[model samples]
Target: MKISYHSPHEPNCSICKKQCRFYDSLREHLIGPLPKAECAKQFSERGCSLCLKVFPTAQQLNNHRAACQSLPPLPAISGLRPSLVNKRNQAEKEQILEESSNKSNISGIAMDCEMVGGGRDGSLDLCARVCLVDEEEKVIFHCYVRPPIPITDYRYDVSGIKPEHLMGGMPLKQVQEKIQQILYNGEAIWRIRLKGGKAKVLVGHDLDHDLQCLGLEYPTHLIRDTAKYIPLLKSNKTSNSLNYLTQSFLGYKIQNGTHDPYEDCVAAMRIYKKMRNEDHSLSATEFVPENGVYSRMRQKELEKMSPEALLQISQSDFYCWCMDSR
Candidate 1:
């Protein structure tokens, strides 16, 4: 492949794809062929060489590498990091957010959860704090959670949770119910499932982990995860953190100290709103799936189907919650 040098007019960023004024080496990790400038600098810092993406921390990049499908495996990567890896395992909950559902009442709600360590080694995630915000960025609910397991590590450096803070804290069950009330707007989950009751879309970063830790479940289609958003993904197709995303997209810093759940919620919601407002168009021909119900069918079977029939089996390359806004 003919490798090109970096163009002054269009310096590519591996993660956000925003035009950079200077050269960035991370573009090498993209699926496309070699570009103008190959990143010649030897980065001593922990970065995914495959994608030329540099993260704020080694642990963050390590978390990204596991989910990067394009990169080949490396040796002795840290497994001690939390399961930010499988955050992309899209649940079939999309069926519930069917285009026919009502979009009134609450459009969406942003949520953030602070975790403390639990279990024998203090490795398991326990939701120690939770915060919910409305579309107007008002805090609807904020509370400390008394984890089911004894706290082994408050992770004070990040979570800011203290032993005293969780004292007489709300139970996990209560937290779940309260969050559900805000999400479901007093409607039962079953009604939302059966009669097409539109629950507010839950917005957050790496929300799967938070939902799992809280023992909560919501329709997959109603989830607006910044971590899995296509435009927010790294060039290597791995997830970016709420911090990096906030700073890059929103022009601010967060999680710089003991993380604030409200701050995180605002960041997630802001990004979601920005994405939702973006002007874009989708064409079926441009977003063909390589392997799915439509692509796997035999030529004869496909030939027998009508245009409307073909449309029924089609799917997009990525999920965009903004489509629902239309």
Candidate 2:
């Protein structure tokens, strides 16, 4: 093939500019064709000579010789120093176990609130009930808190809680404290373990709001939300109500008409456990990087996963970012 060069100082070669069959003959008249042997050596060092990208030095070029375009992209975590990452991973694992141990033996709690039909401005009506359950699913604590706002929806059809139920109920502050006490008491044993170590996991459905409502902050790793575990439910398909996951996973229909604090708590814990088991299994698999042809093929398979699945993989702490970056 003919070759052409552009330079303001030198006159252009007609034969080189034209498409010629003999590159070697033209090479004699111009800068000689890159020394074949040298080009091959550079190829082993710098990559395709035709690409014309320069390496910092010949040494770097030599190192690039083994480079292959077929390799899979490096994982995101690969950029992290291996020694530092290992230490952080070990620390996180220890923290999880310590938190689990601290919270494990403690019973779970469920909460439900009744509100009026006054839109967002409307205040919560009736009592906000909290039910604390032990391992056997028995309620250990239950109480109702009278809200500060007036009850506008006294119609029996709207809120099942009647004015009579509020008569003997404690104030909202007292109710909140009582609920906190029960939770604190149940977790006291774990706290001792945690003091010697760390905190335990808290299982709940839409728990972020609940924890906020209760004025509590739970550790992110310890807070397991059933809503996050099943992305399929969250995607534009169906409502992520506790009732759906309960019926789908546990095969038990719940929240038919009124809310049951005890039942809701049990369901949340059950769902959390199930999802945790699945995550554990996925974590056990060994990750391997393919080389040459196999690397390209494996990468194509990974690309086939749904965007959501790929995102989950990308976010995973186990995945090496350095590997993904490549």
* The best candidate in terms of TM-score: 1
Best by lDDT: 1
Write candidate 1's Cα lDDT for 1-326 as tens digits: 11112221223444444343222223432323554333323223554543345576888877976653221112111121222211212242223222213335558788889899988898999998788777766656667788887898889888877786776577899878877877886678899999998688899999999999999989998899988776577766688888877765565577666777777888898778866764434434533444433343455565786754454344434555557568
Residue 74 CA error for candidate 2 (Å)? 53
lDDT of 2: 0.44
TM-score of 1: 0.62
Q: Pick out the ten consecutive residues of candidate 1 with the lowest summed lDDT.
A: 71-80
- Model 1: residues with Cα > 4 Å off, grouped in runs: 1-105, 282-315
lDDT of 2 by residue, 1-326 (tens): 11112111111123223221222222233334553454345434544222123365787655644441112212222133423432345456445334433554653444444333322444433444444444444444444445566666653443445566555545767656545444444345356346743333445677666665455555564455665543314434343777776764555576666555666767776655443333111211222332212255556766686643433233232221122112
Cα error, candidate 2, residue 282 (Å): 5.4
Q: CA lDDT of each candidate?
A: 0.64, 0.44
Clashes per candidate (backbone, < 3 Å): 6, 24
